[model samples]
Target: MRTPLPKDKCVAAAPLCQSDGEIAIIAEFLPRRIELTRADPGCISFEVKPTGDPRVWDVCECFQDAGSFELHQGRVASSEWGRATAGITRSYSVAGL
Candidate 1:
């Protein structure tokens, strides 16, 4: 279910959409990356989808809020997960939801 944005103070500083993420990983590392992402609590929903070309895979993640999103970002960047799968194109637009 699509969750409504919380009107509480926790979300006051957060963007309207909270978070939107898109990641493109080299296919070989996708399984590991997906594993890492789905393990994060902040990720309200996570999905790994195929690209037409077998060489690429796309990741979609939606976090509960900005804080959750930030937490996930830091975790991914600092953990073995990030180091293990570092490469290819990662495009994220998180500002203003």
Candidate 2:
């Protein structure tokens, strides 16, 4: 089996919908999603922030390495929360800290 790698810091930003219900849904699911990721050895930090605009959400995440990052991405993409927010545009970046 492959040993889990260390965590790497990262950030993600996305353009959310303008609907209040959609924003509520995102708020409800984001905490659970972050909690789930935090339990993984490869996860360092996971956070979600709402921009002043009603149509933007920012997500910051830290993973151990490329492999761990990919794994986390897969999990996030397959999550119900992800599916619910599929309409949004997502952008991600890795940090060296």
Candidate 3:
């Protein structure tokens, strides 16, 4: 995603992405992360949906812009919360990223 210029403000749309995968744990782990990510700056929307298969999950995320998405990734990579939480979960994509 790229920032739109003043003149390009009328362009198509913003950056919205989604992912589908399975997490290793549920308990309070996944919900807690969702709460924190939703409160993050530039996060337009962040949520996870169960696909009824118990092990299947769908995640949707919308950011204010590209910068926000990058920031979120950074936090996920370096934050203590991220490290601890990540250690308990295994995200299986099966195919895509």
Each candidate: what lDDT?
Answer: 0.52, 0.70, 0.53
What residue runs in model 3 are displaced by over 4 Å at the alpha carbon? Answer: 1-24, 84-97
- On lDDT, the stronger of 1 and 3 is 3
Model 1 misplaced regions, further than 4 Å: 1-28
Which stretch of 10 consecutive residues in model 3 shows the poorest summed lDDT? 8-17
Q: For candidate 3, what is the TM-score?
A: 0.57
- TM-score, structure 2 vs. true: 0.72
> Residue 95 lDDT in model 1?
33
> Candidate 1 residues 1-97, lDDT tens each?
3342343312111111111222332434557766877787666566666667444444556666666667878887886656744543444434323
- lDDT for model 1 comes to 0.52
Worst 10 residues of 2 by lDDT: 1-10
Q: Give the better candidate number (1 or 3) by TM-score.
A: 1
lDDT (tens digit, per residue) of candidate 3 on 1-97: 5543232221121112122222444433666767877887877666577665665456666666667666877876675546645534444321111
Candidate maximizing TM-score: 2
